[model samples]
Target: MREKLQLIMKHLRQGSLQKMWKQTIWIYQYGRRYWKSMILYTLLGVMGSCVSLASSLISKDLVDIITGHQTGRLLSTFAAMIGFAIANLLVSQASGYASTFISLKVDSEIKNDIFAKMLVTDWESLTEYHTGDLVTRWSSDASNISSGILNWVPNLIIYTFRFISALAVVLYYDPTFALFALLGIPFSALMSRPLLRRMRNNNQKSAAMNAKMYGFNQEAFSNIQTIKAFDLIHFYTDRLKTLQKDYISMRLEFQRMSILTSVLMSIVGFIVSYSCYGWGIYRVWSNAISYGTMTMFLSLSGTLTSSVNSLTSLIPSAISLTISAGRLMDIVEMPQEDYSQDHAVKLFEKQHKTSGIGLTMKDLSYTYHSGTEVFAHASMEAYPHEIIALVGPSGEGKTTMLRLILSLLRAQSGEFQICAGSDHNQKLNMSPSTRKLFSYVPQGNTMFSGTIAENMRNVKPDATDEEIIEALKLSCAWDFVEKLPNGIQSVVKERGGGFSEGQAQRLSISRALLRKSPILLLDEATSALDVATERKVLKNIMQDTYPRTCIVTTHRPTVLNICTRVYAIRDKRCEVLNEVEIEKMVKEF
Candidate 1:
């Protein structure tokens, strides 16, 4: 026991106490919003405890009345007991129902707020966390915070009130009996310090294990087709078994420690109960108290002991809550995307709705957070009604250029903007807000589980069937789409299942075309299509009446002929391709 205290002092000296207090304060902020509901729940619990206390005292009076034949007060005492019992039962039920309602409400509201924050978080900053880890923190950690916020504070108040009141009753009846009831309190307090340190550590490990399993499952299910193709069914199953074994082993270790702690506490509780029992019977034999008094003493003694145990149990719960809050805080407090120029971008879109916007970059420079340079002093321009091509060997800056244009990544230095015309005075700087001015068709099968029409409408939710079909025809996807029984409404499974790669690419292009944005950036979006189809898609985009500026990055040479001009990314700069250079590139392709 002295060693535990020494360790606690050691922990305090190391400044862990301050860190723990900060985490506690962080969690308390969430609980502060639902003050009214928490107060109501606490009141109900206190009311139930008062009624229960009254019931015990009333029964004592009823017992004495029966034994002494006091017929005058018999009916009244009996009626009071029954009424208090029923009221206590009702309050308990009401409190339980309110708990569930408030818990779910708090959980959903916190999740909704945090989910929105996650979407607006800076893209580069957010990529530091894995998808699975983020989901776990957003879901499991958020739920823990809510449950703790709703229940922990109120339960602490309720249990403490019950304990103090019950102790008062027992002490007033006989102080010696109260001492016997408290025999377990000191021993229970001693056990808690060690258990708290272990509980907090175990919770962190458990949470990590859960996230690892969730991530593995999500990745496996996402690549189930590949797993089947490679005949890795048994290998994945064995891997899952290994993870399960590690999870089970971790849980069992914690459980064993918990079981041991409970056993020791229980033994102490038993000793205390018997001591109160022995002392009460002895007092009754000496005629110092009546049978009714002895019965009431036993009842209050049990209550006092239980309340002590309940109070001790809260420490572990508090520790767990603090850990959960810290995990969620790490994610929610990241740098959010800056939308300071959103209104400006919106105004630009409104003014140039018909004329369309032109992308302009001058002396542009960018380096990743890891210090890898993508573009340095690179400049490019794409005017409305022109198809511009970006060509480079693999590992070059082609895709990186598109990301910079989309403002998914920020440039370390230099200028990026969009304008209505040649006049630089009418230009707006690129930012998260500028994303609304452009439509992007990135590489890969980026389809969600939905129908063909639903996928197209993801970009323009109010798009009509006529608009969807027109966009599809431009990408040559309407030919296959029309063959389906449901046409545009036909179901498209996850990752564009039930369709060829080329067909999916065409459908993606169709969705992008439907957006009607002024600028269209295709980052290897047509790689899966045939040379003729790719050329046709580029031509269709270039000829659109909406004055769309198309920029495409590709390895193929066929689409270069249709481009107004081409740029090759080399040595961290965009090198303009002349007629000779363009012809040489086409021949090389």
Candidate 2:
């Protein structure tokens, strides 16, 4: 638990703006794509401020004219005040509309950039982050940052300028009164500092708890079947209750800090208000200031005091904003493997390529972070028009070896290459396009939530209806698909529900077949299917279809009958097996 906490803190610390600015800058550039809206917003802000200040000054003039008994001057000042009020309202409305427009544009652009980054990120790197945590960072965290930029930053700047301008006006009329009004500054700072710290700590905890709860719920719902089958519903419910209790505690802590800050601000406001009024009355009685002047000073006091109070209130929000900014920076700063360089070797167009797709692993070895080696000096080859079968005891690294060959996980030592075409001279390193030259069906047979046509399009977006039907037929999925209410347009719920395990496997096989890639990887893709269905799919790939290069990792000997070559993996070594030896091992099993 301490180790996990330390990891979370490490992420928080790295979320600094200094580390995050490059990505933020890129996002800002995209936001600036709508320069017209930003420009209009800025202009409206300035105009609104001018109109507001003008109204205050006009009110002061009206008071002076009434006191002097000048009817003409009083009427002129009143008219000017009315005119400024109307202008303020119009400018305020315009500013609000413009600000909203800019905010939405920035929000959309940032979300798009984060999604694009997620797509290119290494698969292993992505596994280190929880889906719930990532969702919060992408949605809630980004929203906080956008709010700070669009609303808080702009409002703070405007109010700050207004405060300074109001202060200057107050000083011009009475310097002593202005000094008394400024007393709220240090008092507010003293009260807000500790409250801001408490709020920030609690807010961070709350955010983490929310992420944990989301993850827990997602897991429980996704595995509802397993939970029901095992009679573990009460266990999961108790766990969720415990998480909710913690979340409530954190929220209460935040609210307590907020209440304390509000109480302190109220005290500060009372002190400043009484002092200003008492002093102004004394000055008026002594003839040191006129009634008009005293009235003006009193009016300005409220604006001045509220501005200071607003500043104090903004502190906690600013801290929250900083925390969110740091979170976003963490994801943006994670080291990304560069794929933009020209190191990519074009294997498809090369003349010395083997007759068909072939894969080779030369002295490949891999070790995980826990120092448990999955493979040691492992090597194997799969040629075109043939199926290579890997047989191993559980945990002997069959799945790990398949991942290495597919470049889903990088090898710690040695290399994985595609040596294919006429001369077997074409060597392909892992590149963006090279990685896509093969289709993989993982062990779990996971399927996304979408229509059958949509899932097929994920493999070959431009495939025609006829081509898709052909692939489904080859995988023995056409009969079931045809029986569905919507046929190919049928929607499969998340994880391919509303279908048997065997049916889902057939669909996955069809999806893989649609890729038309040179190499196909089946990591127990047919494990869930019965013997008959599995045999039908295997036979179709080996004899009846375009015989692409294929690798099948499994322990079932019945599944290996169609393979052109067989490898036995034991004690962290891969050894090629002759047909007689394979038959002997099969009989023993």
> Residue 156, candidate 1: how far off, in angstroms?
1.6
TM-score of 1: 0.95
The candidate maximizing lDDT is 1
lDDT of 2 by residue, 81-131 (tens): 888898898888877776887788777876787777776677666778899
Pairs with backbone N, CA or C atoms under 3 Å apart (clashes), candidate 1: none
Which runs of model 1 end up more than 4 angstroms from their true locations? 1-9, 12-14, 69-72, 422-424
Error of model 2, residue 401, in angstroms: 1.8
Clashing pairs in 2: 15-326, 353-420, 353-421, 353-422, 354-420, 354-421, 354-422, 355-421
Please give, for residues 547-569, the per-residue lDDT of candidate 1 as tens digits. 89899999887779779989999
Candidate 2 TM-score over all chains jointly: 0.88
lDDT of each: 0.88, 0.77
Error of 1 at 7 (Å): 3.9
Q: How high is each candidate's TM-score?
A: 0.95, 0.88
